[model samples]
Target: MSTSPPPLTLEADAVTRITRWVAVGALLALIALCLAWELWLAPTGRRTLVIKVLPLLLPLAGLLKHRLYTYRWVSLLVWLYCAEGLVRATSEPAPGATLAMIEIALCLVLFAACAVQVRWRLQRAKAAAALG
Candidate 1:
């Protein structure tokens, strides 16, 4: 009579939940900062459509719904933002450069959270399938 230990399903659930919230928060912060930076902070005096922040809104609904597929895709998508932030941070002027650095931080946090959530959720699904 061999019996295996029960899976740590609860721990996985908690981790997935925490990571999902973190990703959501980071995304929201990034959006807000982008809007504020573009609309107010910079000395650019000329008002332009805050197109830079619009792309992030595309995944907002899916992320709020806790869609694992969205998490996977957004994780990959954030790298583009990271690259843009890196470039702007180095070349853009003072406040703009500072905002770009903040963008980089937020993007990295969001990407890491999404990646961990996806991995944890996938592993949980696999474990559930194996247990049946």
Candidate 2:
């Protein structure tokens, strides 16, 4: 009788390791861009709304879809962003410079939260999968 192992699955452990790093790197890069903008950009509130916040969100969206981040938390964060944007838009004088700054800051916080949540989820999943 043959004692050969089954053919390697596409989801080999090593591939998951590589994928985890790739996911982390991509999210970190996006987060870094937000940090750069927050730190370096002058307090002029000069950027477009869609251009500024939308890109900041792409990573979180990816994380949620990929299960790198928890779906529930990511969904909540998306809702918060939408609410903040709406509030800032409606609050007198077009969200104001201060409001814009607040928006960006909140975005940074949300991204950080997503990062933490994704790491936690990945660790939990890894542990659960290893118990067999």
Candidate 3:
């Protein structure tokens, strides 16, 4: 018999896929809005840099939603983004503070949704594994 344990598994579902993409879509929309604000409404310089960094989160989010791998890594990333947002919030002044807070809240929501997706996928995989 093999000595190693089984690889982690997922039980991706259609509705789950749709839901994940919906979340991803909303995040992307936020990203676009941030970019627009950065290019338009934002004061300039570092704010653009800070918010532009957000686009980097997209690929990992897409990968997670696609089930390219287990969702744990993505969850960690989302948590990191939330932390970054919080740090930004602390540094923000009156006008920008609200936007920073909004970003933080959205990140938290994304984190929860991704975590739930992972849990739900694992549960389905476990049920299938048991049945088989």
Candidate 1, which ten residues in sequence have the lowest lDDT sum? Answer: 1-10
Total backbone collisions for each predicted model: 0, 0, 0
lDDT by residue for model 3 over 38-118, one digit each (tens)?
565545576646465554465655554467353556566656656756886798775456666777777776666667777
- lDDT per model vs. reference: 0.87, 0.50, 0.62
Candidate no. 3 TM-score: 0.68
**Candidate 3 deviant stretches above 4 angstroms:** 1-18, 44-65, 68-70
Q: Looking at model 2, which ten-residue stretch has the lowest summed lDDT? A: 41-50
Q: Provide the TM-score for each candidate, comma-separated.
A: 0.88, 0.34, 0.68
Q: Under the 3 Å rule for N, CA and C atoms, how many clashes does model 3 have?
A: 0
lDDT of 1 at 114: 98
Tell me model 3's lDDT, rounded to 2 decimals.
0.62
Candidate 2 C-alpha lDDT tens digits along 1-132: 544444445555555455445544544554554445444543235443335545445555565455654433553554465465456546636325455445545545555555555565566566656652
List, residue by residue over 8-58, the lDDT tens digit for candidate 1.
777877998899899999999989987898788873556564787788999
Model 1: CA > 4 A from native? 1-8, 43-45
**Residue pairs in clash, model 1:** none
* Stretches > 4 Å off in candidate 2: 1-50, 57-66, 69-96
Best by TM-score: 1
